[model samples]
Target: MLSKFVAAAALAGAVVTAPAAAFDKPQTTYKVFQFPQDRIPRIDGEFSDWDMVPESYVVGQDQMTDQDGGHHNPDKTLNIRVKVGWVKGLNRLYFLYEAKDDYWDFSLPGLHNDTFEVVVDADLTGGPLIDVQHQDIWKPEWVGQRASKTDPRVPGSLTHWYSHGVQAQNYHIMTPHKDKDWAMAWGSPTWIKNFPFANAAQSYKFTPGQSGTYRLEFYITPFDHADPEGPERSVESKLREDALIALGWIVIDYDDVKTDAKNGFWSLSTQRPMFGLASDLPLFKLMPIENAKLEARWSWKVVDMDRRLVAFHDDSVGKATGWHWDFGDGTSSTEQHPIHAFAKPGSFVTILDVTGPDGTSRRSKVWDVQLR
Candidate 1:
């Protein structure tokens, strides 16, 4: 089944045209590793969970450029490795950040702290992602009017309420946050960083202004439309295997505390303003789990609950050549995907048997697809 799926996906991929590139390094494409559902990484400040991921998926400091030009040689002053991942059925994006720096600065209570800023355009709705970059507010007529608190185009006005971070999102994650939140969602929708939407953990041994290594593990849900009003009116970006999204990050390295000068603004995307411009973010493909084992798996959805109709899809892995589904109603089908309707409503045991080169596998669901 997996081979067949791969072949069909490859054929489909060949026919699909690539999206237009709006940022630097148009030819570059990063991969978001797909973690098997059972082996999803935990949000613990540890590296063991990431051992299953291959080294090739790691995006290190070598791939980044110092946009601020403060650190001409990053390897000597700072180094970082980032790995992005996603689970099959979850919309959240997981990250493992490991870094070593000659100086670690995070004593400040505000934005001046050392940070790891991330930007995501999960739906590729590329454009400005920050309030100040909103097209309507930047018009000539609204330029000087923004200073007035009563102006609708001002920062906290109605225009900013719905415009900022509506299409995309930016997260300013403090490297080792102290006495504050883990990250600041750079828009009106600050709720995106809270629990149930996001979570984080960190491990470090150095104090503020000391030199040491740090480890951070976290996950955040990417939203296609994250309304400032709250999650009730928002929309989460539907994540699926092989989907391509735009994502990038920057490392705000602050070495000195006495002066306000930052050490470097190292960025994965070549563009410096990628933090606020979704168009400047680079492409990242949600990859399939590598070396997945063959198994019989299927899911069903009620097409018409009143009519007792259900649509069943084959989700088995490996090169399945034949499929047999027993609908538990004395009816059976050999179709890879089938739609069936029950004559009466009751608990039933449905079984799906898939045969491949590796042999046969069976999956049974008891009373999982039932209607009154």
Candidate 2:
């Protein structure tokens, strides 16, 4: 049976005791360690059309660089790689990385002013992680992340998530973005409380042991994007918003991943959700991203219901900027808009189609037209 996403709180990585017969085994589960690399494979993403290979490790650490030098500004492509050591019995999987940065930059204007990203990529050899600290985006006229500081990661420091900002700042949609008040729950209930993001070459667990040789799908859920009308209503109905978002993951192909050992040696990357206030299972998210906005406005008034369309002339609408009207009726003419009408109307569906700057077409439908 599919449980609510909030199941994250109860079982978010080592935060609590393993339930009875969690992996068909007792509480004593298997463990994964880091080992010397054997060879590197390929990397891919479902959201992108790119490939990467582990170049080298970040001196003294198990951090490997997996890149073709493309993502997130060459200087910012500062990614590090990690892989799980072979586990035979294959008990369970869990991860709890160390977050060593604490400078916040708001994505929007006049709100929070600290920002960072937790990006992950998997290769045949292992998976690389990236911690982005940014600033200076408000100055640009683009519609994307703009961390304006010359030094993004805590301004010369790698602070943790609970540093300057409150605990678990990333998941709760901590901001003054356009419309953030409605965040009374997590997108997915399995979200890690107080800090869902993780570090490079971190740790994670997988259960029921992926049967034999199949693909190890990797995925990610962005920090502050929400879909009120998402397809998985049953999933959404369970956990809080963050957990829901955590489950709304991103994945990389199986062919792009390569496990070091024979059976269950594949590298896995996962995000866990927890309750900041309580170490309770079934942790629910009662917060907001507070950044997204309410798009279309509701409640429009129709002024003259029984008005007149008094049109005289209207032709093959000249490749005009916007369409005009001559309804051929005496209901309205002073109203210079796209809506046209007819004097002898019994039932008509007024279809007003328009094209935007991107050469994309759209339409508006008005029904049950009666000139009587």
Candidate 3:
């Protein structure tokens, strides 16, 4: 374990000394395979909408074997595979945990029960990790938390966010389960004095699929914790385009009997201390634009009192050499800039299509035009 400050200084140096191309490379390498969500899934234990979410990555951990071919873990059924997805619209990251188990044991006294931990590095651009170990120090960094199945005094589920060894935030009934409906009604900042810390605000839903496989979906909303007047910050601001982020996953199993002194544990994870020098961790990048939008421009002048012809321009986001315009009057043009005349029209919808960066298919946008 690197001393937190030393890690912070190293991170700061890396961010400052790093060259360009940090933005463009991740756009292709860590390209997030996300989908548009017409309706964000309710944080209930239902996962029907998750099927449409494109799977971005997967990491699986099964039981191990020794040199003698002996079973490393007796609980072979405790093995787990995690599937993850991302949706920029909701500013949420989803996860699915497929654990092979006959029964469910979530009654938690400690780390002895079935549980999962997600560690995220929100400082995609790289910086000194801030307020991680203690509230007094603010260095701008990443965070991690362990979300357990259930706790008696803590209602539905218990999630603990800590820095170093200090507890920063605690949430109860926030993690939804397959058997129960647990929802976070509000951004419960009161639970932690230093609210809005990086990776602080989060929501999750868990559902059991098939006989022994189960899935979990969750999201995080990082905010400015120093603000006394609380207001939710834009998650995109932290997860910037082309920026790199470190994500870590760990799943633990206890296999029945949640007792005072817990035993029987198996675990797996990515390298710890997710936030630091960029080279120190496995990083993922945020795409420049998940989907393309258009910038429509036109030059028109009145030929007479109530008649005019216009030349419409296709000024979309990315670099493009081709354009197709649907004038919405039983007419279309494939020119980069098209000239059209609207005769006797009240309202018309115009569409623009341009190929994306790949130059393979077309990306489109529409605008409503009103002529009087």
Ten contiguous residues with the weakest lDDT in model 2: 120-129
TM-score of each: 0.84, 0.19, 0.47
lDDT of 3 by residue, 17-60 (tens): 12223321322233344433444544454667556544444455
C-alpha lDDT of all candidate models, in order: 0.81, 0.22, 0.40
Write model 1 residue lDDT over 101-192, tens digit each, in one string: 88888888878888999999876656677755444633223111223345554566665455677668899999998899999999878999
lDDT score, candidate 2, position 133: 24
Superposition TM-score, candidate 1 onto the true structure: 0.84
1-372 in candidate 2: lDDT tens per residue? 112332344334212222322211122222223121231111221211112211221111122122212222222211223222211122111121111111112233322311112221010001111122223211111112233434334433322211211111123222111223211123222232212221112111221122121112111222221222232321111122122111111111111112211111111112221111111111111122122221211111233446534222221111223432223233323222434434464544333332323332323234434454
**Candidate 3: where are CA atoms >4 Å away?**
1-31, 37-42, 53-56, 62-75, 108-112, 125-212, 223-243, 256-281, 287-372
TM-score of 2: 0.19
Give per-model CA RMSD.
Answer: 6.3, 22.8, 12.0
